[model samples]
Each structure stands twice: as structure tokens, then as C-alpha cells.
Target: MTADGPADLSGLKIDRDAPPPETGRLRRVLLWGAVTVLALGGAVLAYRAANPASVPVAVARAEPLGGVPGAGATEILTANGYVVARQRASVSTEVAGRLNQLFVEEGSRVRKGQVLGVLQNADQKSALASAHAALASAEAREAEAAANARETSLARGRAQQLHAKGLVSQAELDQAVASDDVARARVKSAEAEVRSTAARVESAQVDYDKTFIRAPFAGAVLRKEAEVGEIVSPIPSSGGLTRGAIVTMANLATLEVEADVNEGYVSRVHEGMRAEITLDAYPDERFPGHVRQIVPTADRQKATVLVKVAFDRLDARVLPEMGIKTSFLADSPATGSAAGTTAVAAAVAIPKRAVREADGRAVVYVVEGGRAVMRGVSPRPLAGDRVAVSAGLAPGELVIVEAPSTLGDKSRVRVK
Candidate 1:
């Protein structure tokens, strides 16, 4: 402390009025208040940056003004499908020979009678002609036999007349009768020979026809396995002398998806249920089809029922033996389109994020009038990213796709 003065006024110091000091209690209160405000502001900013709730959404979500049936409906099950037709077959014949001529190449359009190929049949053709000539000869013989039988009948009659007049003996009459009987026998033999010749002709004709292979149906040739002059035969042990085939023709319109429905889901897959086929070849487009038949028998080996979905339209790109994915739309459109001729019912489904557990209850935050309204919910099955909603959620209801902690009744939200 300075000894002389209550207030030191040094030569360097001038008298200046100073603000009054605040009361101790008020000063402490004001300091604390200021600290509290700053702390509160800092905490709010931090929280707004850290949490999704405070994130400013550029697009306002369409609020679920009200709940409707299927507000959060989701698909419970899903399966892939392939576009296909109902009638398809791989044609093979018992006849085998050297492939003499291939009438069609791969991708050639053909009619039912259009010959796909012809096999070497020089021997068969010659046999047919010979058999036919023999048949003609036999027919002539049959006619000659009839003439001889009539002549013998007349001779026997004349001999009988002579005997009656005593101009011919009984032995002569008997001889005439025998001669007539022999002529009848010749006629019978001739008839029999004719039948035999006819049989030969038919057999030869079959062999000749087999040599000229014909298409079984109207379709496009999918593959050509042989070239003209290539030796081919259907002989099983011919050491592959049987070149695979002259041509593989398929009615593309007859394509069908052979789907093996899981035995568990087969019961619901009755014939006439719609199906959508999306071929990997055409991913963006959907093909419409219908279940033509459900095999009553299940595959004992695979435990699945074969569901045949037939496409209504034919496309050149669609070929047999292609891998496919089929989806049964929940409410599949029945009508057809250029995109496809297939349709399937989609299963009830919902977004994966809408379902959550709160207070030990599986719940969904359904938006009602722009606010998150919590509701009790259940899920049927877990699917890709989405759960099939069994209860408490309806289709078309606005729900929070992103689940946030503390998301409950009356929470304000901005939906994407």
C-alpha cells in the first residue's frame, strides 16, 4: 500500500472516472448466464451437425396424409423367370444315313413341310423303283390268273356237257374239274404275290421317305450341324458317323419357361397365375406370359413343381436352352406389350428401413400428415433390403426409409 494517499495520483496518472463495479452476487449470476448461453449455442450446433434429424433436407418428403390399405406393403417372396413358349421339342428321327443335302441353314425361316435336310438314299430310291415295278408285274399276273380261271371254268363246263351227252368219259370230266381247281389255285397264288409285292413297295417307300428328312413344324432353323455332302447317320454305334444333325429348327413362338417352383411355394402357383419373364438377353424389357400348366407331379429329385410359362409372341433372339429369371409381379398387368408378352403377380413388399424394433415391438414409423407416427408392425420374411410387411403397415403409406434412433410418434421428418 502507498503510505500517503487514499487514491494515488502519480504525475503520470490523471483523474479518470471509472465504471462502478457490479455487485458480487449479480456479477456471478451474469457471468454464469453468459457461459450457459455460449455453451448451449455450441451444443446445439454440434448436435445439428452430428445427427440426421438436424440435417437440412433439400426436398420435402410427400407426407402420408393418411393411412391406406397396404401402406407399407412389401414383397414377401421373389423368383427369377425366363421368357419361353409353351410348345417346344428337339426333333430326332429313327432314320439315319449320310446327309446328302441340307435344305436350311441356321436362322432360316421354314414352314412345316419345309425340308430341313435329306440323307443319302441312292440304294433306297433304287429299291423303291424296283419294288414298284414288281408290284406292277404282280398286278398283271393277277389279271392273267383271272383269265385262266375263267377259261378253266369254261373247259370244265364243256367236259361236263360232253359227258352228259356220252361223248366224253367220266375220267375226262374229272380231269377237267382238276384242271379248273389248279387254275383257281394259280389265281390265289397270283393274288398273294400281288399283296407281297405291295408290301415291298410300301417298305421301300418308307425307306426312301426316311432318306429325305422333313421338318416337323413351322419354325426357324436354330442351328445347322451338317453341310451338304457331309456323311451323317443315326446309327448308334457308327463311331460318330452320325454327324449330330442336319439342322435344328425350333418354333420360337413355342418357347416356354420351365420353372421349378419350390415345393413350398408350388401350392400358390396354380395355372393361370400371371408371370413376368425377363431374359438376360433383354434385361430392360419385360416379357408377358401365363402359366399354361402346372405339372401335378413334383420333381421327386428336386422337390419342385415344374411351372411352364408360355410366351404369346415370338422373337428371333429368344433361343432354346437359355438361362432366365422370372419375377411374379405383385399385381401383374394382364395386357401385352412390345416390351414383352409375360406377366406375374408381384408379392406384397416394403422398404427394408421402414421396419424397426422399438420397446420390444417390431414397429414402423408411418408418416401421417408429415409427421412420423409409430405403429406396431410385423414382417413375414426377410428379402433383399426389404421385409415383407405382415401387419401394422399398409401399401402406399409414407414411411421413414431411414431409421433413426429416437424416431417415434410425432417426430418431424423430411423424406427422400
Candidate 2:
């Protein structure tokens, strides 16, 4: 039987295709794990794409008002305005002519009576010369007439003497008197002509003076309206190229702010009210000012009244037509410097919009290292649209004023 079953291979069949059961299970598990990881990663990416991680927000700094004592009284009202010069003029010539010379340029400072420009003077000069020549001729004629009158008076005297002596007829004496009278009348007529010619000369001189455009007041030139060779007119001309003004000038010393107060809040502002003016161009600097006047009329369309605010001390930095913000105060800004010092010491203020409610507590999103740091603050109502931060805010920290509703603590924000 052992011989018959020679080299039976059934018990030892070669099976190279089959793997170990444990190894097969391990490979299936690894494949499924990789697929599950990829699906989860795709879901995470979609969710992130749907909801951005960083939000854009408008932010404002938590400003410390150096201790504004009675800030409430100090800033009773706020209004937007623009700086304007009380003495502003667009200087033009009295006569229309081609501009021959431009003495001043834009931004040039000029003194009163300074020659700013000159019109073409050839015609004017000619007219003036003609008038002078006429005046001279009239003077010469007047001199000649006076000489003739004197000669006639002497001749009449001689004739009377002769008549008295019975050496001349009565008719001869009468003719001599008539001749004298006629000569005197001719002299008078010549005198009148001289006066008329003198008046013409004066008129011509005035016309000649009109050719030079002079500054009415000392000021800084804001704009150059006409260049040399451009025509300038005293009155507006039909052609657009004819400029009515050679230059627009403003007295920098007379720079003031003209604010528009809402009619509803106009009652809060009054003449001589102290104010703090802030220029948009110079945000860090605050200029002291006072309400100079409240316009009698109101703008029907804007529902606002114009208020003039004059700076207490003029600064060269101040300019006409600059955007400005004014805060009307209760006391006079000129009383003393101490009042300003006190105002600077009183409070740290931030826009009311910066304070947001979080978990039933008043909190502010302070920006630090490009991330929003939620700080719980004890906010007290301050003047205008600001709140004083009694706690949890420093003077220079930036706070988010307008943020998305979903903004949370530690949220990354892009400040606008």
C-alpha cells in the first residue's frame, strides 16, 4: 500500500495565490480607514468654504479723553461741518481783456493791494495817452485864451483914454468895448473846454487802473483760474474759456468751520458755545473753537441749520473747505487752559457701537495681535454716541465697532 501511494501530493498541494487570513483582514481595514479619512477631510473643507473663518468688521480705537471733567457738559452736541474762510474772494478784473501777466500762482500768499494779474493794456494805454494829449492841448488853448483876454482889456483901456481926450469918436469907443467883451467870453469858453478835457483824463486814468488786478485783502491763493494769455472778465462771459476770476483766494487767518446741526438738536447749540473742532485731515489734533453764529435760516431739504464756529487760535494747518467735526461744549474754551486739562483727565471713551452684548454681559471686542479679544467692560453712558469705559479698556486699544453677529471671542477679524 505504501508503494501504491507513491509520492501522493494531495496532502501537500502548492497554494501560492491565497494570503494569510489575518493579513487580508488588515488590508481591508486599512483601505476603509483611508477612504473614511478622505471623506471626512472633504466635508471639513466644504464647511470651511461655506463659512469663512475670518470676518470683516469696522473698528474704532478706545480713546482716552485725557480726563474730560464734565464731558457730558463739555460735549452737548456734535455736528459735521467744513472749514471755510470768512474772507474769501475770487478776484477778477474790472475790465475784460486778455491776461497779459499773472503775478500770483496757486498757493501763493499775497498782501492786500498786491498785483495779482494784469490784463492786456495796449488799448488802455493808448486811450490814456490820447486823453493826456487832449488835456495838454486844452491847457495850451486855455493859456492862449487868457493871453488874448489880457491884451483886449489893455486895448479897451487905451481906447477909453483916447475917447476921453476927444481924439476918437464915441462909436470907436463902443466898438472897442464890444471887442473886449467878445474876447472875454471866448476865454471863458476855452476854460470850460479845459475842464471837460480834464474830466476825460480822469476817466481814462481810472480805466487804465482797471487793467491791473490787485488783491483786495491779504490771503493765500487757493486756485489759479486764469493763466497768462487766457481772457478774464469782470462779469461772466458767454464763452467758457473767459474766466471771471483770475484767482480764488482765502484769508487763512479767518478760517472757520461751518457746521450743520440737525434742527431737532439746534437748541443745544448757541452762539459763543465752546467747541472742539477736529479736522479729518488731522485726526490726532484738536483745535479749540466757539460757535460764532447760528444762521437765521434753515435748509429745507437737509432739515438742518448752519452754525459758524470760529477757531480760538488760528493755525496754519487749518485750511478752507476741509472736513471737520465739532463738539459743542457748555463753557467757553477761552476761560483758561485748566479747563482743557480737566477735560482730558475725566474719561476713556469709545463709540457706543463698540460695546456688544455677550452672554448677558456687556463686552467689547478689543483687537490684539490681529485677533479679537473679548473684554467685559463696565460701560457708562457718555456724551454723544460714545460710552465711557470704566473698566477693562485702555486708552489706545482698538475695538471693533461694527462686527458680524456671529463674531465670538478670539475670532479672527479683518479690520475695515
Candidate 3:
């Protein structure tokens, strides 16, 4: 280390041999500036190679379109829906009692008037027997009263004879007459008893009949709530009704699809509108149906109207509680199938990737005369592969399938 700058310069001996030493910040700055400019130019060249302003694209001829927007185009819509059985009912007991016997199980086919189950009826039996006995006694009494009435007439006749012949005292004759009157009253009393007992018999028979529960309609039993010997009661519980359905039965033939239609369009829907139904379980197949009913009531909260659809032809695969999608073609169909005209066959299609939104309109880049051009078009679904063009582009006009970022009107393009 040198103590002073003057001592170090003497030992270094001037390498004046090393040409005149460079000096001045301005000259050094200028030298660096040139090197930086060369480096920037090289970088710009590399970037041009990485991302070119002009992109290569493909071109294809547009198809001839009919006067119609596009031939064979389909307009698809999506809506949430649910499926339900048309004929549904809860089988409940009319009276409370212990279940005595259950013949049918869940999913059992039952006929109208078929015995589904029986309720414990020891009390009913007693009531019926008592009623029958009372009825019989009343009948016997009525018959006896009629005979007494006849006998009383004879007694009156005898009494009259006694009075006329003076064979008996006036007081004795009066007593005979009073006895005949009492017999007549007894006959009237027996007749009243018979009438009352007949009513009791009818009531008792009804109670007895109720003990054996029978099917109200011909259908299948979907569920069973009571088992043999189970003490079931229709009493109120936490749910307000302790007795649930004894069994669920449905007339499968009367089954229908119930769906909610938007209230805005419900007014247009009417009875007899043809419908296309597709089950979630069967995606490929579509079943035919007709609008059987449109519920007059609307669900105000949901703003939807309930529509009931009946099958035109029943399929064995169709069952209750399957999810379904219903398509309504029109409010009123003209004739034949209501699916509509086939527009998907004659339309020219393009991938959505090839389209772009510009100036608040749907547009696509068309390559024509060695340049990129924009064409406004209305797109509709076609064969699931591409959307058909409705307007603006003509047949045999080449369009850029893939749009380039730097592309513009009359922009040079290399077709790939």
C-alpha cells in the first residue's frame, strides 16, 4: 500500500507505452450507448421470430343457404324439471283399530275390492251380534204385538156383547175395554222398537264391513305401513296424524308426467299439444305425449304453471317417479309430428372457436383475395360440431377458421 499518490506513480513507471489512456465520462458513455443499441436491435429481431404479427390460418368455402335463416338448424333451450306419477293416492284407514291381518306387501298388485288388510274386530263382531239379536227380539215383539192387537179386538167385541146383554156389570165392561186399549198401545210400542233396532243393525253391519279393509281401486300396492297383529291407531301424534298411509296404491294406467311451465308461456300451452318426452334413464329414446291438462292454478311464488302430460303410447320401460325432460314445440301444433321442419340438414357449420364478438355483433374472420375480412353472422346449432351461419357470408366464400390476434381488414395471411 502506498502512503501517498505521488510515491505509487514513480514505482509504476508510466506505462505511457499503453497508448494514451482513455478519459472523459462523455466518451465512455457514448461507447456504452452504441453497445446497448446493438443489443436492443438483436433482442427485437429475436422477439419478431417468437411472435409474428401475421399468423397462418385455414380457409374454407361457405355453403349455400336457403331463404330460411339456415337450413336444418336447431334452437335448443335448457330448463329445470321433475317427473311424477299421474295417479297417486295414500291408502289410509277410516277408523282407528289394531291391525289384525295384512295380505298384501309393498309393490303388490291389487284389484278393486281386494282385501288389502284387516283390522282387529272383536268389538265389531260383538256389536254386530248384539244388533242382530236386538233386531230379532224386536221382530218377535212386533209379531206378538200384532197378535195382541187382534186378540184385543176380540176382547172388545166380547166386552160390547157383555155390556149389551147386561151379563156383566158396567164397571167390569169398562175394565175389559181398558185392557184392550192397553194391548193396542203395547203393539205400537213393539213396532217402534222394531224400527229402532233395524237402524242399529245397519250401523252395526257398516262397522263390521269396515273391519276388513278393501281396495278402493284396481292398482298396485306401492307400500305397506301395517303388519299382521300390529296395533295401529289413527290417533294424532307429533305429526298431527299418528296413522300414516296403510299402503300406497296407484293406477299405473292413469300415470302422467307433471311438469312446471313458465307462467309467461303457459298461456300459450293448451290441451292436446303434442310433446316429446325423454327419460333421464333413457337418453337416446324419446316418448310421445299429449298435454292432457293444464292446471288452472299457478304457483305465484315460483311463477310457474303445472302441466299434466299423458302418454300417447305406454312403454314397458316407463315407470312411476322417473326423471323426465319434456320439449314443447309449439302452443298449438298444425299436423303430424310437432318437432318442426328439418333445418339441420342444409346449414353450413363452423366451430365456435372461429367466431368472435365485435362492435356488439357476432362476427367471423373471412380470408378473401389474400386478406382477412370480418362477416357478421347469426349462429345456430348444427350437428353438434359447428354452428350454422344465418346471414352475411355467401356460399364458396373462404373464411379464416382460426383468427389471428394481429389480423385486420386486408391484413396479409398465410393459409395453412
Quick one: best lDDT, which candidate?
2
Q: What is the TM-score of candidate 1?
A: 0.55
Off by over 4 Å in 3: 1-83, 239-242, 263-268, 296-303, 331-416
lDDT of candidate 2 over 287-340, digit per residue (tens): 666889999999999999999998876777777899999988774243337546
Off by over 4 Å in 1: 1-76, 84-86, 235-239, 259-270, 293-306, 312-323, 331-416
TM-score, candidate 2, is: 0.63
Compose the digit string of candidate 1's lDDT tens values, residues 1-416. 55774765477664568655666779899999999999999999998765536321122122221111133222233455454434444444457666766667777888887667777789999999999999999999999999999999999999999999999999999999999999999999999999999999999999888887677888777777677776665544457555655666677767888877788987666566555566776665445556788778987897878778776444556677777776543342355789977532222356556667878978767667656777787654322344555455444566666645655677666665
Q: Which residue window of length 10 is worst by lDDT in model 1?
A: 60-69
The whole-model C-alpha lDDT of candidate 2 against the native structure comes to 0.84
lDDT of 3 by residue, 1-416 (tens): 56654354467565655645565677899999999999999999999766456668876667653322223222222223555566678776777777778888877888889988889899989999999999999999889988988897898889899889988888888887898899899999998999999999999999898888788889888777666655556553565335555777888777678888888878666788666577888776555567789889999999998888877657767778888887654422123446764323333545656778888988888876666887787886432245567566656777787755767666767888
How would the candidate models be sorted by TM-score, starting from the highest? Answer: 2, 3, 1
Per-residue error for 138 in candidate 1, Å, reads 1.9
Q: What is the lDDT of residue 126 in candidate 3?
A: 98
Backbone collision count in every prediction? 40, 9, 7
Instruction: Score residue 231 of candidate 3 by CA lDDT.
Output: 53
RMSD of 1: 25.2
